[model samples]
Target: MSLNPLRLASKALIALFCLSVLTGSVRPTQLEVVRMQGEITMVTRNSPTTFYEDRSGPTGYELELAQAFADHLGVQLRVVVADSLSDIFRLIDTQPGVFAAASLTRTPQRERLVRFAEPYQQISEYVIYRRGGLKPATPADLLQGRLMVTAASSHSERLHDWQASNVPELSWSESPELEVADLLQMVAQGSLDFTLVDSNEYRMLQAYYPTLDIAFNAADQRDIAWAFGWSRDDSLHQAANDFFAHIKPQPLLANLAERYYGHLDKLDYVGARRFLRQADQKLDTYRPHFVDAAGEHGFDWRLLAAMGYQESHWNPRARSFTGVRGLMMLTLNTAKELGVKNRLDPVQSIHGGSLYLSRLRDRLSDVPEPDRTWLALAAYNVGFGHLTDARKITAQMGGNPDLWLDVKEALPLLSQKRYYRHTRHGYARGQEPVDYVQNIRRYYDVLVWNDEQTQPLKGEELLASSAITVVPPLL
Candidate 1:
């Protein structure tokens, strides 16, 4: 077949144009995909599972995992915190171009919208009830009355599905302002009959609210995974899969899990509330002592105040069952070591406490900054030997020894001979220090915020003139 030259040339050009379009759409190779050149944006929630600010800085299970993943890829990790799960999904759905990973759960509905990596962790939903409430043994029992669940949560979805099929009469109310913790609180206080929560969250909360009972576990378990935008970019997907494959074997990942989920105790709300109220009153009187101590020790006064409130509610006459006494609760040995004649003297107590805490911090100089501070606080409550024992246990259990979260898990094990038998500090009250440090951190934050709200600015003329260097005696 013979064709004219012009027609042949036109057909050839068309074929070439089609080929160029195909080539342009082709995905880049893993090696050629700008290796270690771009920032890896990881989207996560502010919940404990994802990211949150602690005394040290930003931390959480997902936060650490994402950071480690970024390091493995040789890219700087930029975390994007979302206020809610819906917001996270919206961001991933709309701005597919921005994020590299979304630390979220893998569900059938979400799978249709985004690609998910291999499962990282397994989680289940549960019904939390007050200690004396009727326990719901099954779905049938839950249908007997009104129930509460977080808005737009997997709990709601599961309940909705169950109602539609198994229990036609089942109905539930939703709380928009409440988190799982709040729901658990309501249940614990007997305000609500029941509420649903994630099983992992329930475990963590159980440590604080030990009396709260789990009515039942959800019928199915949810697998949590990292999500990516729906695209044919198999290279990126393949890279993610490869990265996750390495994560499980790494001691750091296990450590991250233990840090956030392990070493939790059920909190006595009645006792905690009473303690908090008394601490509030005492904070006003001890404010000056904290300021002086902060100056003497080169630490944040608010932090010292927080520590005191946590230790003894800032009560100068406070005494613990373990023989820790005074405003900052100095033990006899610690007071003697700090050259304090009397632990009951508020000024001496504060100064001694600051000195002891500073020494603990200084002793851990090799540890990273924020972690060093956390370990010091833990040691201040427990003892250095016990803290070291916990760290060793954390390392042995495939956790990061340098991380406070991991060490916190190990702290509790110090009370258990199964793990602590080999430690230099044999049989210590590991749980006390964990609770002590956490409560102190929470109280310290509250006091700092409250002080900021009431006190005048540092440089204000009246404030400066009225601010006596020495705290006046309480009237």
Candidate 2:
């Protein structure tokens, strides 16, 4: 009954051929190939809204989502940087086992070329122009100015659709060499008339480019999702949909959005201009002190400087109504506890404040970072007791006490007598802490951007010293 080895091999090959004829082609599923390779390759573009280098090596809103999806599949994530939006799609078209997660807006044209996973976020397109420039009130007005968008982008597609259908006069050019951020900068510099950008991107960059303003919303809200190369196998696409479904009810997506965008709207044009002015005129004088304190305490010097600015606007002689004084705005008791003989001395105040913040973070050892750092900041503004009371209130409600977003909600409730009367620390201006933390975060972001722009020639190691971080260094 046993067959010869050569005959058995021939029989097996014939069976495989018959199966292939029936199924068209037999190949490993995309998910199976990824698992077998032990890694998934993702293509992304370099932008603040997508993937970019920071102190933590590489991170961004889109990168975070990609990493989560990779983890969901039980594989490692490998990122390949594409030079342009066109290049991103080209890589997808040519490569195997690769996907795009560059905050791509799903479009009809794109849907024909690739498969987009479930949409994770929605954003509207806006026509951006410099302040004091000719503002376009409608699509017709865009014809008057030089409007341009990135090549192969959703913005360009929208413009094309508009031009072909209703506004035949509405014409725009595509920039093969520039990105949305570059166009934004050009508009800010008065070199470009107008450009199209997403609402979220506009919000994130508005503080940095104070001169930029929205002319009008150009398109309706669109779905943003991950894109897979066109293939017969929808295995990976279904897996990505499953991953999104699993995280839909989780805090990861919300928290990531909050981390990247929550504080963006805090600084308006006037506030942004003032911060830039002071940073130019006064930051140089205290820069060394901040750096020294940061080195001693292992904090980003920009964070300390931002905190200092928020506290007293970087004035050494500044004093509050509550008797807090100096650049870092320390109370008399806090200054004494930190061994500062002269509360008005900028060096002493800066060091004392840094130490106090580190200690406050230490007290929050149980809380997970970013929330821990934000909560410590709130504690720095209000008090540890009030922060604990806020946490208690957050827990009493159906909110996650560990999340800053939820805790921030409960924080304002402390101001109301109805809620404060039951807490251990009654009657605190909870709204102040929320504003305090947000202002500091905004300042920190601007400072980071300023540093990066000024030191573009510096290598990554030097640049990383000015990068942002959510985690506090251990004492």
Candidate 3:
């Protein structure tokens, strides 16, 4: 088949045209499906800022923000959770209608690989090490320890930039196999002397590992945004810009960020350190009851413990001035209704509270869970009548009745004469429950992070359904 080069090229072009005509196929540009198919696939990177499975399926700022864009387009949302950042790049490259919600930072190298939307968040990089370990007070201080970072993360990139331009003293190893959370765990375990993580990442993990501390800022104010594959058409990118603008004024972005990071940093180091110590010192005696009750009621034992802490700080003999008493802090009427002979007994209190929360949760079967769990917690604080009143207000005010996010804002309005006047339940200390639920949620997050369950849930699957595993770091 050795013919003239021009003749061979002409024949190949002719064949390509013929094949396209026969198949009736036209390749769409990146993210063009929103125009033709009215939908887009969201690529989730399984991280706190990007995507992580929660007790209520996938819940993260990335997932929620992506959902908002999908809703705006009047299209169906198809979620694809990427295994890693590399997987995200590959998917975005080969697939149309796919965009990344990985909270990816805009970097010069990445800009060549993919286009980024307008920045939604600004974060700083930090030098992290265990609390009592070597403190890197300055750039010179970094030389005193074994430094490591996740291979592809922005932390490593920052180090590389420093190495190139300014600080020849800057040095660190990279862990190819570790996720950012696993890196945080490694530092907490003292496997690595120090590592670099973003400030938000450091703050979020500090709630879990109170022993980890920030030595100094590595880099400040990097922009984080969504990433899409490079393409000639900019329809989806423009739409993303519009979406962010619309939500910014409505403060949706701030609300979503608050849901994840707001309650963090509320519990101080001593308070958190005390909680972990007590979990070791005291939780064993009550673990059996918590585990049993949690199983029967479909609640995490940590959740029940958080409730116990919020109510009585794990003191079975503790009593409130309102006459509520014990670890679960049951009122006399609640105790009588639950058939408790003695409200002061730790066993009875835990069981009764678990049962009560279970019953309340059952009432919300029509609603989505995790949010339902949150609503149930609020009902436990104020009566169901008041909770419903708040829900009604939320619905009337152009918000979701079933979403805890909306209902929480409306909850405090119940104390206002203008709002509560229309309700069956009269004025209540509305701010108390709002704070109550938030504080317990903080404790619950920490508990889930610090403890491993003794028993796996039988036949019942958690809403997240799957998890990521990390191998122990190589020294």
Candidate 4:
């Protein structure tokens, strides 16, 4: 009954082959494998809106949104940083094997190659100029020619469109290496006569450089959205649409808009003049407080001085109708919370304010860094509950909860019930914090510059102080 050796060997090989086929049948297909794992690969650019570093850590609008999306999908997010817009496109087109979304501009040209998610925000283009420079009223005025912009930007696209349609003879060189902030800096320094920027960016920059003016608006608006690779995965596309559909613009966004842009139009000439003169005289007296408080809280002393200026104009006896009193303007509750018995005591007031700010910052540990700082500033002015509501509104509006820009936009919405009741903090006057932060930032910058200008020339040798150290006013 036994078979020959060769025949038996052939039978064994066939059985082994059959067993292999049985095992292979249970393995998953590529699509099923990816779906089961649920990991999303997102591509983003390194910029203030997309991603950047601050005193805290990684932050930006796109970064927060990407993280949110990953959380929604119940997976880990892998962000691939692209060096340029062109690089982002190339990565999406060629590495279709990996990336799920590219937070990019929703342009006709881009739409032709990739599918775009619903528009999350709209960006208006504008021309930036120095306060006393020749302001261009129209595209034709630009033909007189002193304008520059970053290369490969939406601003460049708008400028090109302007040239092709209205000002055919206008010409300018592109500074490819310059970011929008750098371009604004060039305009501020009068190195460049004009530059183009998204209106939101223009507002933020203007808060810092009040002397910079918007010469004119561009002819068109750019809708910004997430770009997805051309795929048959209609489910992912539909999910994105659903998320955006539920997202509504809230008052917080409005407050942020006002915080950054509103006061720019109202220059506060008298208050500014008073602040300038007083700051020059008293900055030294409070210098030690800044040094001490900044050391304990890990903040710039100049920033502390700036905050004091914004809060109480550095007046030891400053008092607000709202019951905020002292040089740092601590409310009765805030002063009590920080263990300060006298709100008017300069040392206690500064220490209490710094402690309060530090606590606000710690409350937002879930938020990313620069944003954490920005949100803390908002909380410092408006209170923590209001800030939390703004973050919620930011999320509800399809914006990043961890981004200052997004939260800023959401803050003002607290005044409206249609949006505020859904928040934990109920209702608040969100605009105050936006204005408070912007003013402090402006005052701080001027103070820093003033300090640097006077440091060496007065023959006063200042030591290289640690993160904290206050100096007496020389003048």
Question: What Cα-based lDDT does every candidate model obtain?
Answer: 0.71, 0.86, 0.79, 0.69
Per-candidate TM-scores read 0.69, 0.89, 0.78, 0.64
Which candidate comes out best when scored by lDDT? 2
- When 1 and 3 are scored with TM-score, the better candidate is 3
lDDT of 2 by residue, 30-113 (tens): 889999999999999988899888664788998988999999999999999898888889898888789999989999999998
177-229 in candidate 3: lDDT tens per residue? 46667667667766667878777777677776788888888765899888888
| Candidate 3, poorest ten consecutive residues by summed lDDT | 457-466
Q: Which of candidates 3 and 4 reaches a greater TM-score?
A: 3
lDDT rank, highest first? Answer: 2, 3, 1, 4
| Model 4 agreement with the true structure over 1-475: per-residue lDDT tens digits | 8779999899999997898798775544333444677866777766545666544566656666667666765677777887666677777666543443433556666678777778766777788778878788887787654677765566666666666776666677564445566667666666667878887566544544556777878746778788766766545666667665644444433433343344344335455566677776988899899889999998888888888888887898998898889998998988988999999999999999999999989888887655677788888889888887888778878988887767777888898998887777788888888777767766764565456543232101111111211211112
lDDT of 1 by residue, 120-189 (tens): 8888878877676778888768755446775556677777777767776677666544566656656665
Arrange candidates by TM-score, highest first: which order?
A: 2, 3, 1, 4
Q: Model 2 — which ten-residue stretch has the worst lDDT? A: 466-475
Which runs in model 2 stand beyond 4 Å of their true positions? 1-26, 455-475
Best by TM-score: 2
Model 2 gets an lDDT of 0.86
Model 1: residues >4 Å from true position, as ranges?
1-25, 29-37, 54-58, 97-103, 130-137, 143-148, 173-193, 203-213, 266-288, 291-315, 318-324, 331-333, 336-341, 377-475
Candidate 4 lands at a TM-score of: 0.64
**CA RMSD of each candidate after superposition:** 12.5, 8.6, 8.4, 11.7
